[model samples]
Target: MSDDPKQVLRYPQVQAEELADWRFFLMRLHARFRTGSFVRGLELVTRIAEAAEAADHHPDVVLTYPHVDVDLHSHDVQGVTSRDVALARRISEIAAELGVEAAPREVSTLELALDVPDAAEVQPFWRAVLAYEDHGEWPEVTDPGGRNNTLWFQEAPGATGEAQQRFHLDIVVPREVAEERVDAAVAAGGTLVTDEHAPAFWILADAHGNKVCVCTADGREASGE
Candidate 1:
C-alpha cells in the first residue's frame, strides 16, 4: 500500500469492503472487537501492536475485560490514509484469527459542545479545568490521553432565557447507524430537534430541551450543506 502523508482519504474512498469492520469518524478509523476475555483481549492487542509496528503506524487501543477498542489514523496527515486502511484490514484479520467478532455499530466517539458567546474567553478556562490540550489553534480541547470526550466551543447568541442550555454532546457515529440511533433516542422520549441536516447530523433534544447532535462524517466532506 502506498503511504502518502499529504493524501487524505474521504469518507467515500475509505468505505471499502476490506474495511467493513471499521468505521470512519473524526478523521480516524474506529472498531470494537469482542474479545470475550481479558487474556484473549491482551493477546489480540499484542498482535495488533506487532502489526502496527511492522507497518510503522500505530493506533490508539483500549483494552477491557470483554472488548478492545481500536482507533487508527495517520497523525502526520491528520486523517485516514492508505496506511490506516491497510493496518485496519490487518487488525481485522488478526481478530478473525482469534475468533473475535467486530462490533462496528457500537463504535462511536463523543465530543462536548459548549454554547458560548465568547469562545476565546471561556476556552482557556475549560482547557485548564479539564487539563485538555488544544487542537492546533482551533477552539477545541481534547484529552491528551484520548480517554475523555473532546470539548469544543460553538458561538451562539448571549440570550438569556428560562430554558437556556449551555452545553450539549456531539455523538459521532457511523453513517449507517445514525438513523437507528436517532430512532432509538426518539422512542426513549427524546424528541427530534431537526433532521434538516440528515446523514450529516441530527439535532435531538430531551424532554427538558437539552440538545445533542448525532453526527456522521457523511455529507460533511465536499458535499454542500
Candidate 2:
C-alpha cells in the first residue's frame, strides 16, 4: 500500500483490460546523478520531464533528497499498457544518455525448508528422483537450474508431528516434455501423488516422502494472463 495518490492512479488493476489492447508496458527508472549537488537533482527532473513531453507520455516523477522514482503507465488506457512499455523503454534510453543508472528489475525464487525426521534419507531420495548431482556439505538438491533453484533438507531432531506435508513443490516443464520427465521420476522411485486433475501443475512425491509437482509452462501462463 502506498500513500502516494500518483502511485495509486498509475497502478489500478481494473485497468488491466485496457492493458490487454495496449502494445507497451510500464517501467521505473531511477538513479543518483551526481554525488553531491542538489542542482544535479533538479537537472535530472528537468531532463526527464523534457523527454516525457517530447514523447507525448508523461511519467509520475517523485523526487526525494537523493533519489528519484518514476512511474510510467498509460493514462489513456488507465493502466500499464504496451504504449506504457514503449514510453518506459524510451525513458530508460534517455536516462542512460543523461548518465542516469536505471534500477534493476526484481525476480523471485521459492524457498522451502521442511522438517524431515531423517535428513539423510530425504536428501538421497530427492537427489536420485530429480537426477541432481551431489553438491556435498550441508546436502542440497537442485534441478537443472542449479543453485538458482535449490532444495535443502535439514534434520529436525525429535520432531514428531505427523507428515501432513502442508507445503509442496510445483515442478514445471514444457507440456511436450511432461510425460518423459514424469516417467523418469517414476522410474527413479518417486511416487505419483496425484494425476487427479490439476488444470496446469502436476503433483508428485519423492522416494523419501516429500511432495512436488511437474507442470506445464502454460499452467503458469493461465494463472498470470
Candidate 3:
C-alpha cells in the first residue's frame, strides 16, 4: 500500500528469519541498465508491468533511468506465493521480448531435498516425471535451470520405517491436463493414495511409496488460502 510505486515493488531478496515464505523467489536486474539511461529504465518498467498484468500479479518495481529492480509477491495472500513465481516467469519472458539478455549470473535456482526410504526408486520417478536428470549420487535427482541452481532429491538415511511424510509437493496442472498426467503417473507405477474430497486435488504415491499430489491450479489457489 506504499504510495511510491518503487516502494510497492518487491524485489526478490533474502527473506528475514520471520519471512520464510518470501524466500522462494530469486530476484535479478539487468546489470548494464543498472546505472544506465532513464528512458531505457522506463521501457523496462513498462515491459515488467505488462508481464505483471498478464499474470494478474503485480510486483514492486524501482526504476532509475536505465536500471530497474523488481520484487514479486502475492499481495492477496500477504506474502510470496505461486502467483509470484508465475509473474516472475512472465517478467523474464518480457525482458527477453525487449531484447535484454539476462546475464548468466542473474539466474538462480532453489534446491529442495526430500527424504524417502527408497531414494533409488523415488529419484528416478521424479527425474523422469519432471524431465530432470541425474546430478549428484545415483539416488539423487536434480533439475538445472539458467542460474546453475538445482532442485535436488536425496535419500533420507534410516527413513525406511516412516509411514507418512512431513511434507510433499502438490503438482498442479491445468484442469484439462490433470487426468492425462495422472494416468501417465499411474502407468509409471504410481498408486492412488487418496482422493481429495474437493475433486480439485488427488494424492498419488510413487513406486517407493512416497506421496505427491496432482492438483488443478485453481485448487492450489484455494489450498493456499
Best by lDDT: 1
RMSD of model 1 against the true structure: 14.7
Those runs of model 3 whose alpha carbons end farther than 4 Å from true positions after fitting are: 1-108, 128-150, 162-164, 196-199, 218-225
Q: What are the per-residue Cα lDDT tens digits for candidate 3 across 99-165?
A: 6544434423456667666666666566544445675444555444332234455556666533755
What lDDT is reached at residue 120 by model 1? 69
- The sequence of per-residue lDDT tens digits that candidate 2 reaches over residues 68-114 is 55655555544554445555566566656767654434222354576
- Model 1 local distance difference test score: 0.80
Span of 10 residues, lowest total lDDT, candidate 3: 13-22
In the range 105-207, model 1's lDDT, one tens digit per residue, is: 9999987776666666556544543446788778898988888888887777663232687666677778787787787777655678799987888987654
Candidate 1, TM-score vs. the true structure?
0.69
Error of 3 at 123 (Å): 2.0
For all candidates in order, the CA lDDT equals 0.80, 0.56, 0.56
TM-scores vs. true structure, each candidate: 0.69, 0.43, 0.45
